[model samples]
Target: MKLAAPIALALSLAASGPRDAETRAWWATTATLSNDAMEGRDTGSPGYDRAARVVAARFAAAGLTPLGAAGGWFQTVPMAERAVTAADLRVGASPLAFLHDYTVNPVGLPARLDAPLAYRGYCGAAALGDVRGRLVICHATRKPGLPGDADRAAALRAGGAAGMIAIADPGFTVEPPRWPFAYARSVRLATQPAPAGGLPQLTLNADALGALIAGSGQDAARLIADGSAGRPLPAFDPPARLTARFAFAERSLASPNILALLPGTDPALADQAIVLTAHLDGYGRGEPVNGDGLYNGTLDDAAYVALLIRLAERRAGRGFRRPVIFAAVTGEEKGLLGSAWLVAHPPVPLGRIAADINLDQLRPIFPLTLLTVHALDDTTLGDDARAVAAAMGVQVQNDPEPERGLLRRSDHWNFLKAGVPAVNFVFGYRPGTQSERIYRQWYRTGYHKPQDDLAQRIDWKAAADFNRFFFALVARVADQDRRPAWKPGSTLAPK
Candidate 1:
């Protein structure tokens, strides 16, 4: 039986039924937790620990079962953290100063470096600077073995480069750098870095580098390959002549793996539950090392995660027709660690899971017009998504920037790795279509700066509407009578 939801369900949720005090509480919780001192929840910090406790408490209050690997809410996943310090990044003796001569990502934003930049190209592309026997820098944007990256790196190493330096791009920054300013504060958004790897690396202070990049374009690139000239190395040792004084360290760190469940009312459908997720960790504590601090992590996933917790509260009273596992995962920033752990050692049998809905973000900007059911092109899940969105009165679009790599970026990727069918919700990929120039403004100004704080500009009405639609869609999927199936030879598990 097909049930048609109110086409205006997006607008009139207030009049639809019981007042959603739970959703409101969830929002309050997110805002409060994110707003607390200790730099807005740096993972592994005291603030993060407190944040975890609060979430666990919230989950418990909402009546979620303890499905953590250890049977409690906290599943401590130990991470081996390393920061690359020393070696001011040289290429055969030509001195490359941090951000001035060759601005590398190093650790990207967390575990920043003050020395020994690894300069990894991660498969050499132009958007990223060139490297040959020189230290290379890159973000997590590129694919792992994109034809020539490895070849070039190998060639560079063979050419006598000392090491590689790479920093994963802090994915989707809302704007550029700024000190803590009131103008930037108040707005709250969220997302997680696209899933990425294990590499010896470092991070750069974007503020310092942004200035350098703005001044000279090509000259900035040359200075980073400092030692490549074979002996006449630039003298930067003296802090005054020290065009770059980089510092970093190599150490270990851990990440988070969030889990939530909505128990099914139906016996069979309940047995086959759904797994949803988003990463909760950022680039890990400061540069010249592997990463930085104050990752405030809104879209890096605070907001996405907030949504799951909120949904759990809603589902708690109503109860799931099928068990819903809203896993607020950690370590997705570090090789899908949390999701991998769950798939490997799930609270329930992995096969019992019917499907997964991994949410990264619809877009930082709310009131988004289109919905991108990313990577569901060949699956039945894709059809379900389209139908669900159409029913909600919104247009559904395919990922326009598939080349930017949305498919392998979110936590849902792990479910896919484990042979579970999954679909990710993507919004605002194309700069032009979203809101006539909104995307462009974000890329230039708010991409990753301290400026990406809460503000009046966000489409709260749109975001709220989308969330309502998402709530209904998931409900429809969970309650379907027929088992969702993939077409023959689809990249998903064999039917």
Candidate 2:
């Protein structure tokens, strides 16, 4: 005898295993969001609008109430963008290729630039001497006690340099510099102030450093070696002059942030809400990598956004003790603009936001043995994350590589700045382990590249495990009596 259709389907799902079903569901959402038809979901593009509509429909189906602008599902975010349409550069008659040899920062660049070249080692305040009105070249280093990008920029600007050209460090293996930048562009919220008197910056391919230093009686190879090794280097005038012309195209556009809410069941705890956020934007078509131009940002962020949808669906219209906001934000690739706008113009009172459990930078390519928790000591939300991970037999550790500046890279940083306790996670691996190998390989090839598509390999079990952890953690934070708070003496705590 044949079973009824619903009963047979349920039996099939049970036999196929719950984890299998969940993985398929999660991947289905991720695939849809990152597919070619979505056109990479560039912020303010039609593709991003389509993706937002899909997310809004999913939220509605999951019984979420629209909590966006004007009682609709989307909060429109106005944006201004600038893109370099054409550029020409010649250093002592050596015409370097745009994107192939170098890419300008494209912010506050003059229409024309003609200046002499000065090799300022590290561009530190002490190393830079009489660089006024010259284009200063510096070695980009991440070593301890060395001047970083910000410090270098400040010193060059204060020293009255016309521009700054930094050689991309070749020795930083953690995140090796990838040549052939797609393009140079900058985007900001329309209401935000434009950068004032910013120095024009350029990043020269390390391999192209010789072109800039040729005929100066200095060995480019030796300088690179010493710079990469953090050794002392001589500063002198390179026998070259830079002449460049740039043309830019500017436009204004708007994208929507998909917002939904699940109200609390308990009146006492309902005033405090837990905010869950993930960005919905990805790098659109740009310079082709291996003949593929589309950057399907699957694990980079689309997958985490999918995880948010899965959590909403799993709730099945049930309310927790405290309300929860599901915010699929936009413009994270454009410097966290959407989350910033949301925090500034909140649907609910900013004070009601007790904590943020952000979903980004999570790659479950290997077994979920260890997790790196960002801001692990800054707030009580870290305690909730720790308890959730520990219950699943996963070890939690503080971010081991703070030099990457990941703490300020994602949407959670905006919430954290607003004094809402926030936490984010990364799949961790021990040194020299297979997990480390896979993790690093992904960064080199898949991170922000066209290769980060659905075709990439995924550990289904690990994905399911993270999804479970996220669900449990949200429940723990939403149902607990005490709202999440900043730990005393935490530097990130709001003054």
Candidate 3:
């Protein structure tokens, strides 16, 4: 399964040109960390430990000082893991394949579940019928007037349903639901309390809708079409029963965050450190898709982390006016656990941390013309980002899809919540353009699936341009005389 050599060589050859050195170097690091041998760098797994070691070695070679726990290169984070060892689900006599036809949420599950099926369109408060002790099936919709996941779940739980099975809405074309989940697992910090008495949840593949309602006197295709078109849906009890048996596995483990520092040369500004963060975790080994089970999160965050290492190399032991801390965190896919831990128990005092420049959700597949800047107006950091992007012929905009909640989805939110100015980015595309098509394709196929490996297409020039912009932005934030401050009248700003 060691495929790093061939992949790295191919990437280097593809990046050969005027900017070959930087492109090849960054892609090489990415290939090394995301290769099959790294096992997708799952948090608390041995693969992640190996990746952390490589990052620490790279930091050492770049002449950065280790700033982890006990003067070492690792910050140990304790965590609890829960997984579905085995699952069998059936709608009457038709059995549903786990991970392919459906996947369960891995918080906790009872050993056995046998309940009648109840279909309530959108599962809104008014639409839910007498679902007491029934297995409710809801249409997962994101329409403005529809009940979202939280509202639907609360309504179902209050209706005394034994469990919920939400049919994935096909109409969410912006980010279409992809079938065949990698796996079902959940992780949380050991100190956090485990969920109590929460209703078990499952997501049914929209494509497999027919199997669930075959004998229920309803047409699956019509129901899906009506749901997608926002038409009213009929509520009924499918003449069937849902029977499931689950085997649960639980364990305790610890993962480490790789921390390094490039100390400032000026005594006055040295104490105020600018923290740069990117998560170092991926989906790891999961249910096989296209016969490939490994979910190498190449573009999701590994590329940005490699960008961090490249930046350090470009520094060549030189220091900015203010010190910079490079943090490759863990457990982001599970939750924002690593960054939360760092914020709560920081290596340096929270007051001394001037700002956070997060690197995640940057996809350089298309030309780097537009960028979606998260937290674009909350702090002065946005001002600095706009200046840097404009100088490179790039236009920045606030998140175009606010409903996705990109602001709170990444590690930067932890720092921002703690009153530290922070920002993250996404590759943007204009409507009705090739860039939009490509961006949408990636979200549907590569966002969290096994297809996100090095085998995917990459725009070398675009990647290099983003790297330069990132380097310039970091230097601008670190060398500036004034600290990044929250803008006036901002909702997130401290009172």
Q: Residue 90 of model 2: what lDDT? A: 95
Q: TM-score for each prediction?
A: 0.69, 0.94, 0.97
Poorest 10 consecutive residues by lDDT, candidate 2:
1-10
Off by over 4 Å in 3: 2-19
Model 1 lDDT per residue over 1-495, tens place: 011122232223324422455444434544544442424454455666666776778788889987775678866666544333544544324455543333433343233223322233233443233333233443333333342335544544554433344332333243322222111101011133322432323334322333223322333334433222221222111111112344545444554565667777888676688777766554323321112233444555666677777777777767767778778776665556667777777878987887888877455464556787875665678888888778767778777766556688777777877777788886654454547367556545443333333321455556676677678768877887865555677765554
Estimate, for each residue in 1-495, the C-alpha lDDT of model 2 and write its tens digit.
Answer: 012233343354345533577877777778777777777898888888888999999999999999998899999999999899999999988899998799987778888999999998888999899999999999998999999999999999899999999999887877778767877899999997877859989999988988998889999988888999999989999888999999999999899899999999999987799999999999877778888888878887888998899989999669899999999999999999999999999999998888889999998889999999999988988899899999999999999888788899999999989988999999999999999999999988888888887767788788889998999999999998888988999999999
Residue-pair clash count for candidate 3: 0
Which of candidates 1 and 2 reaches a greater lDDT?
2
On residues 59-165, what C-alpha lDDT tens digit does candidate 3 reach at each position?
99999999999999899989998899999999898899998899888775787889988999889989997999998888897888989999998998899989889
Ranking by lDDT: 2, 3, 1
lDDT of each: 0.53, 0.88, 0.88
Q: What ranges in model 2 sit over 4 Å off? A: 1-19
Q: Answer with 1 or 3, whichever has the higher lDDT.
A: 3
- Judge candidate 3 at residue 95 and give its lDDT: 95
